[model samples]
Target: MKKYFTQLSYLLDSQAKKTIPLLILSFLFSSVLDVIGVGLIGVFLGLLTNPHFFLQKFPDLAFLLQGLSEKKIIGLFGVLIIVAFAVKAILTLLIQAKVIFFCQLLLVRLKNRMMIAYQYAPYTYHLQRNSSYLISRIQDNIGSFIGNVFLPLLNLISSGFIAISILSLLAILHPFITLFLVSMFFSVGLVFDLFVKQKLSSMGKIVSLSNGEMIKTIHHSLHGLTEIRVLGREDYFLQWLSKISHRYAHAAGILVALQQIPRYLIENMIAIFIIGLTLGGIAAGFSISGVVAMVGMFAAAGARLLPTVTQIMSAINQIRGYLYQTQLVYEELVELESITKGSKKIKSLYQKFDKLTFSTIFLSNVNYQYPHTDYSALKNVNITLHKGQSIGLVGPSGAGKSTLVNVILGFLEPESGQLLIDGKPIDNLREWLNNFAYIPQIIFLLDDTLRRNIALGIDDHEIDEDRITKVIQMAQLTEVVQQLPEGVDTLLGENGVRLSGGQRQRVALARAFYHERDVIIMDEATSSLDHETEQEVINTIKTLKGNKTLIVIAHRLSTVENCDILLRLEKGRITKVGSFADVVGISS
Candidate 1:
């Protein structure tokens, strides 16, 4: 229980920390009300069975009943009982509604906070993690944390308070008998929990694991649909998902059954215990009225007490069954918080600067090694790039062309190097990166209007129409936009599935143009275009040669032959650097 509470603390933010204590205090008030309602019912039963007993027991109020007939007294007590019960019911409902609303609100806030952390986390953090796992952590795991762990924990606490309150009232009435009954109930409950605790915990872990696997399987199968269909292996992915689904269903079913099974057993035990109590009372030679009143009071207490005990046990079982999710989500929350701790300050610093103003960027003695690798991806690499120079990189596959680009883009940091802007070290990488527009080999598009995709992060009202039109023409996407039914308003489908390869490339180029950055980096951006289109785009790029700093990586010789400077890289080192003809060993 202590460990679970610790894990819960890790999941809560400052607001939740404050809200939880207030909620628990409310639970305490609710439990007091439960005791009051039950105590009133006991007094009501005592009067119904033996009016003289109440007159003798609560003698201070005996004068009020002197003029009243028995029926009138019973009728008045009945009204009091109804009112007590009604108040308890109303308060319970209000408390429950508050609990549900708090859990839901916390769920939303936690999910949003986690997403923001992921967005601001270092690029290396994303490279090491799987997208499917991260997605499930956000969508599925946090929900399980709330429903299975936090809600059940709250129920356990609330039920526990009510059970103790009811038990205390019963003890005040019949001390020895209540003590024996509580001992018996607690002994039975303890034995049952010991029997099922390990099994329930194991099943919970299995459920968490299976949920993540199922999500990963589905993510992979959907993302690789074309490959699966081409390979004629639909059953392969289906079988994988089927196996995980079966495991998840089986574990989840067991947890549900185990949590509820205790209620039935505990209910029967309470019934048997009450019967024995009545038999024992009769054996003590009490008069009929006395025994009836005693039994009535005990029965009323039992009625309220039994359900609370059962609820407490059920809540314990649920917490045990979902313990793994609690721990998993706790760890995730802690890790995300630590990773994004400095992100806010960094983001603020990034916002302090506008467009970067620099004539040169120099990589001084840069060195980078990939995680868990013996070899450096960029070893003693040095390069200088001037603004308004069209530079090209030509390299073979796996020759570190992309790594160098990533380093230059500030996605990867060198072990020992300084990225200098205008001959001074750049202290703020985020601001520096914001001044560049990057186009990668692969394009990712949102399922939104083409216009929104082009101006991806801009608000609708803030988008400049004239600038959009100009970029559309510059990227050679004017014809494509006109061909669409709604022009730029047409939906692009998921990841631009509706567009052809060249058209997608054109859209990417259009997006870059819309950003209007001082530096444009294209990593094989025109590889998807046909010969004529590629040449036309290259010519468009040539037009920006003297205006914007352009860095282009291409395998095709003709692609960079007209550049102001060309570089050839091999095995993480720059092998050649000159104008195209000088580097290629051919006269211009």
Candidate 2:
């Protein structure tokens, strides 16, 4: 229990501590109102059974009732009792309204915290985690944790206060009877709770783990729909999905059933206890009138006490059921915060880097190994990138070209190295990254207008039309756009499905050009283009010869033959770095 709630407590301390004062007042008001409302009903019952006997016990009320007859006094008490209950109902509604809003607001804040953490977390953190797991935490686990764990935790506190109020009332009327009923019900609650606690927790674990697996499977299948269909592996993924979904459904169903079972059992058991009390009173030879009044009070109190206890138990079961998910969310947020500590100044990846002058980027004695792996991905990688230089990286698979690029791009920090911009070490990565615009091998295009794809992140009205048009012509996307029905206004289908492979590469190129960045890094950018289009892209690269820095990663050496310098990396080390002719055996 301590282990499960450690993270939860930390989350509450960080996120929801502001609500504590108001939340305490809400619970206190609710409990006090319940006590007054039920106490009025007890007075009405006393007046019904034997008005004079009750009036005799409360002689201090004689002055107020001086001229009133017994019947009239009883009638007045009935009206006041109903009024008390009516007032309590209205107050309860108001309290519930405040609570609902408070709960929902807390949930929203918690989700926002998770989003910020994920956004600011180091890129290395993202690499080690599963996309499905991270997405599930943000989208699904948060909702479940709020409903089952957080809300229930609130209900548990509220129920405890209300139950104490009812138990206190019972104690006032008949101490011996109150003691007996409390002992009996408490034992039953304790024993039943102990019996089912482990079972519910186990079911919760299964549900949480199974939900993650199911989401991962579904995400993988959907994201790889094209590959799955082309390779005829649909049945394999389908069967795996069905198996996980079945397990998730079963575990979730069982958890729900367990949370409700205790309520029904407690209700029936309370009924039997009340019946036994009634029989015991009859056998003791008390008058029916006296016995009825006594039983009536117990009935009203028990009615309240039973449900409150049942609600408390049900809430507890739900909290236990969702224990794993709650802990996961808390830990994720906390871990992200720790990993991304001191990153406040380095916030925006799109911040202006033009003001920071840099003549060269120097890498000295850089070595890197991926987490949980013994083998080094980059070894003693020493290199320099000067202004207005075009560098080509050519290597076989597992040659660590990407790793080296990642280090330079600030996605992965080298284990032991000095990466200096000009003469000083680069400290702010987000600021450093603003110097380059990256075009990946596979471009991720939104199903939006062509203009938006070219000038991404800028609003439609805010996009620079002249820049978009210029990059389109430069990247050779102008011809394709002109052929479309609406030109730049044409909406690309999902992942730019509407565009051909070569057209998509051109669109990506257009986007890179539109950024107007100081440097451009193309990751196999022309692999999708035909010979003519590839030459077009190469010609486009040549246009930046004296204008901007370029880093090209490609297997086709012909594309990089005109590059100022070629880097030939074999294994994890750069074997040759100089002019293209020096790096390669033959000249361009």
Candidate 3:
């Protein structure tokens, strides 16, 4: 329990300082009101049964109420009972209102934190994990954390305060009955805990795993819609999703059943205890007033204590069921430590990027091997690229062309040698990435307006129309824009599905032009384009020859015909380094 609380505190961070105290104050207030309300019920009933009793005990009671008869006393006490109960109800609802609102608000903050952590994590961390799993952690898993851990923890605390307050008041009024009630009900709760602890733990694992699998199935179906349709295997994925979803639902339902069954069992036992107390009062030969006061007190305490005990039990079950989920949140909350291991000194947002000019990139016998792999992806790779040079890399499949680009981009750090930019080793790869425009074969576009797609992260109002028009012309997309009814305002569906392959490539090129970076890295950007369209893009590339650095990576050697220098690679080593024709003949 202490460990769980510590994790919760960590998850809340500085907000725990405020939220924790507020929760304590609210629950404490509600419990105090409840205790006062229950005590009054006994006083009200005692007045109705025998006002002479109080009158004799305090003779001043009759003197203080000059015009009051027994009837008037009854009426006044009855009104006081109603008012006390009404105030208690309002306070309880107010406590719940504050707690629920704060919990939901905290949920949004937690979601934002999850996204921020993912953004800060290194690129290799993402490569090692599936995107769908991360999405599940952010989406479904956090929801479970709220339902199974966060809110339940709150419920457990508030109910614990209410139960203890009522039990203490009952002990003051009738010690023997309080002892009996505690021994009976608490013992039963202990027994139930021993009965279902293991089952709930297993169910927790099932629900967490099954939910993630269901989400994975959905991600696969949505992202691979074209492939599924072509292979006529849509039903296979559908069935897989349903199977996992049903497993998740079943586990969740059983865990809820485990949580709920205790409440009803505790309620039934409390009802029998109440009946037994009433009969015991009659058998004890007490006066009508004494019996009425005793029985009323027990009834009032039971009315409050029963539900409090039930909720406390429910919360205990919640903690047990979501132990794993707490661990999940704790891990993600601290994932930043892994990302901070190597380069703990990079904080460039915009200013450093403007001055991030480089003279040359020198690779010194760089070697990299993927984990759990037999061969090195890049072995003793030696390359030196000067500023404002158009360099092309051509190699066969599995010849480490992509691996070399990733190393240069700092996505994967070399295991053996150093990558020096302008003769200085760079600790901050992110700052270096800011100076590059990576135009991949596949452009990731959202289902949004063309202007927003081109200016990806900027708001619609912040998009510069002049810059958009200039890039469109540079990428030879002006003619395509003229045909669209909305022009740059046109909507591109998922991954630019609305445009043809060539048109999408041009949109990507226009985006690169819009970025206006010092280095543009194109990875088979014109692989899917026709000969005429590819030549047009190549002409645009030739126009930027001496002004900007271009690193063109492709399998088709013809695409690098105008490159100033070409590096031909075979089996992770440079075979030839010369003019395009010199390397193209040997590579082809």
Candidate 4:
């Protein structure tokens, strides 16, 4: 129980100061209304026992009751009761509304922070986590925390105040009966709490894990649809989905049983206790009115305790589960480190190289290992490219080709070694990156107009229409655009699925070309294009020979045959470096 409250504290930390006041106000109002109602009941009973009870108690109070008969007195008491109820209702609504509103605000803030953290988190964080789990935490768990945990807590506090008022009234009327009822109530609550506390918590964990698994199964099935269809594994996927569904259903059943059975048992016990107490009170020579008031007090107290006890238990379970999920998201956000200002400012592969020289682009004893990998992807690799030089990087698969690109792009840091650009350490040349652009093998495009996708949200003033057109022509995409109904304005489907693979590659190339940076790094950019189209793009790149430095990665030997220099890498080390012809002869 202490642990549960500790966890609740952390969950409420975001809104604690703001919500506490409203909660307290609501509870106070509820207690006041309940006490006033009980006092009214006692007064009405006293008037029944003696018509002039109010008059005898205080003469001034009696004068205020002049011209009012018994019915009118009862009616007046009813009005007071209604007023008290109205005040309690209004206060309760206001506090609950504030709490729920503040909870929503806190949830939105937390989600936004998580999103921002995701952007800055290291690549390994993404690799280690599942998208479905993250999505479930945001979409489902936060809502559960507010509705199941916070709302129930609000209800529990309000009910507790009512219970205390009722118990106090009972004490004045019949102390022994009040004590007996209180003892019975607590005893039953304790037994129920002990019986289902662990079960509720365990059920909550099962439900949460099952929900994540169900989401994962659905996500995987949809994302791997093509693979599933191609392999004729629809039934297999369905079976897997069914297993998750079954687990969720089983856990839900247990949760419902745990929630309902204890409440039913406790309610039955309260009913029996009420019946026994009523008989005993009459036997003890209590007057008819006193007995009625006692029964009324018992019923009112039960009304408060039953719902409060049930809701509190369920809220505990819900809060525990939600806190775990929230902790996952919070931990993820807290762990992410923002990219340094220097990294973002480094030149892209397409930057200009007027003063860039061979010695300017040098990596000394570079070493890098991928996350969770035993061996280094790039080890002690060294190379240099001069300005205006066209260099081709050739290597087998997993030969550190992509890792090399990632390093230069500042997406990954080397375990050891220094990368330099323009005769300065790469970190110092943050602003120097404006002169380069990169075209990766797999291109991504928004589901928007071809022109907008290529321009990538650049303002019209910054857009170079002529340069864009030139690149389109060079990449052989002009014909494709012309063939479309909207030409350059035509919308590309999601991930550019509307375009052929080669066209997608060309669009990426066009974006790089439009940038017109001093250096262009093509990481297998032309692999998807036909031999002829690839040649045309290469020739177009050569046209800018004196203006830019070009570094190309190609699997096709013919593609790099005429390069100024070629570097062959193997096992994270550069093994051969020379002109294209010289390296090819040595490789052969």
Candidate models: Cα lDDT each: 0.82, 0.81, 0.81, 0.70
Q: Candidate 1, residue 41: CA error in Å?
A: 1.6
Q: What are the TM-scores, per candidate, against the unseen true structure? A: 0.95, 0.93, 0.94, 0.82
Off by over 4 Å in 1: 1-3, 342-353, 525-533
Name the weakest run of 10 consecutive residues (lDDT summed) in model 3: 346-355
lDDT of 3 by residue, 289-383 (tens): 68777888788788888788888898889888988877887797677644554455323321244435788999999998887688898889899
The TM-score leader among the candidates is: 1
- lDDT string for model 4 (164-251, tens) is 7767877876798779877876786678777777776677777777788888888888878899999998898799889878887887
Colliding pairs, model 2: none
Model 4 lDDT, residue 217, Cα:
85
Ranking by TM-score: 1, 3, 2, 4
lDDT of 2 by residue, 1-588 (tens): 687667667766443677766777788788888888777777778778887755676888778878888899888888887887788789878877877787788778778878888877787888898988888888778888888888888888888999888888889878899888888778877888888889888888888888888889998899899999999999999999899888888988988888888788778877887788889999999888778888888888877787788889899889988888888887788777766664653454325444356889898988899898898888898999998999888887678888888888878888988777887876666667767778776788989999999898888788988998899998877779889999999999889989876688788878878876778887774344467655744775688787888888877777777788889887788888988788777664
Error of 2 at 192 (Å): 1.4
Total backbone collisions for each predicted model: 0, 0, 0, 20
TM-score of 3: 0.94
In candidate 3, position 201 carries an lDDT of 92
